[model samples]
Target: MAQECRIPHTVLCPARTPTCQTSPYLEAIRRQLAVRTRRLNDTGALTPGPPTASGQSDDPDTHDGPARPVVQLLLCRYLAEHAVEHLRCVAQTRHRHRCPHPIRALTGPAGTWRLLPTGPRRGQLALPDVLMAIYDLGHLPYRGQLRWRAQRCPQHDAAPGAADLALAEWQPFDPLLHAAHIRTRLPHPEARRPGSR
Candidate 1:
């Protein structure tokens, strides 16, 4: 009779710990950690790459090219946290000042997003939740075309003059920016300084 190879169950075996043995929740957590690690390893992953010699530009206005996957993810996450009311026209006027126009308006009793029409477009275009999911609007059809129009005010969208627009800038997304809103209760009143009030 062959000798029985007895091993303590408490000891974790290298081969025994296969991914298949892990719980679905643990597996999901592992996958998320792996993704985060990969992103961290990639330098400047959240930001767009430098303009390439092959005509690839970082300026969204000039370059119709697809945005990087990381950038798209960051943008989607940021936009999700910050409402449309916070967004402003990125376009610059002839005088070199930022355009003083809201990108889109929350109109009506329901407060739906209505695109400020470019011209005699009488009907208000309501932005569907499905449409908001799109990161790069350039790929979509006419609806996407209309969506992109919101990036600028009606004046700039209708007549984009020859102006050296600013290059699109990207910064690392900070979840803590909206920490107070996510919390269950407001910060204790005692936390505030006496003179600040």
Candidate 2:
């Protein structure tokens, strides 16, 4: 039987879940974005866009925008839906076996987002920056570039001969050939009231 999805607002079974095999990593990214969005909003660092027809402010957390958090979330979703295999360690052991470890940091959000000091005076303010800028950067890398950079896990990263043992054949990823998972739309804010199913 397929596994149950624990992701909020999602109802798909494992077979139909796009991130079923990689939900942990994707969830971490999502949580980071949500937290950052909240922080920025609270601090007034991010200006709310014009109100929608329903008079609700456009929430950066759920809407696509030029903001860093939204862009990062979108990038992560694209990666999760298309190049998920790249999210795993690609290093080859001396025995010609692929590393079993995942490429994502095991320490969750803190491991991905680190505190960084940045301001006009260089010490006036501290902000969180993505550890590797992989998912946080606004620009997406060229095709296969991320996979090449994330080829090894922390343990096998510097292992001698690891690169030499890499598999020779590599298949290109084609999103069209894969089954796309259905994305659950977030309900209207009013529908989230108590006793509202």
Candidate 2 lDDT, 7-126, residue by residue in tens: 543323221344435557775665676777766554435555567999755543332221121113223322232222234576776677777765443432211121211112223334
For candidate 2, the per-residue lDDT at 36 reads 78
Q: Candidate 2: where is the Cα deviation over 4 Å?
A: 1-86, 108-134, 137-148, 164-197
Residue-by-residue lDDT tens digits, candidate 1, 3-79: 99653432322223443466566556556765765453232233334668978553332221112211122123222
Task: Give the worst 10-residue stretch by lDDT in candidate 1.
Answer: 109-118
Output the TM-score of candidate 1: 0.27
Q: How much is 21 displaced in model 2, in angstroms? A: 43
Candidate 1 Cα lDDT to native: 0.36
Residue pairs in steric clash, candidate 2? none
Q: For model 1, what is the alpha-carbon lDDT of residue 194? A: 35
Best candidate according to lDDT: 2
Residue 176 lDDT (model 1): 39
- Estimated TM-score for each candidate: 0.27, 0.27
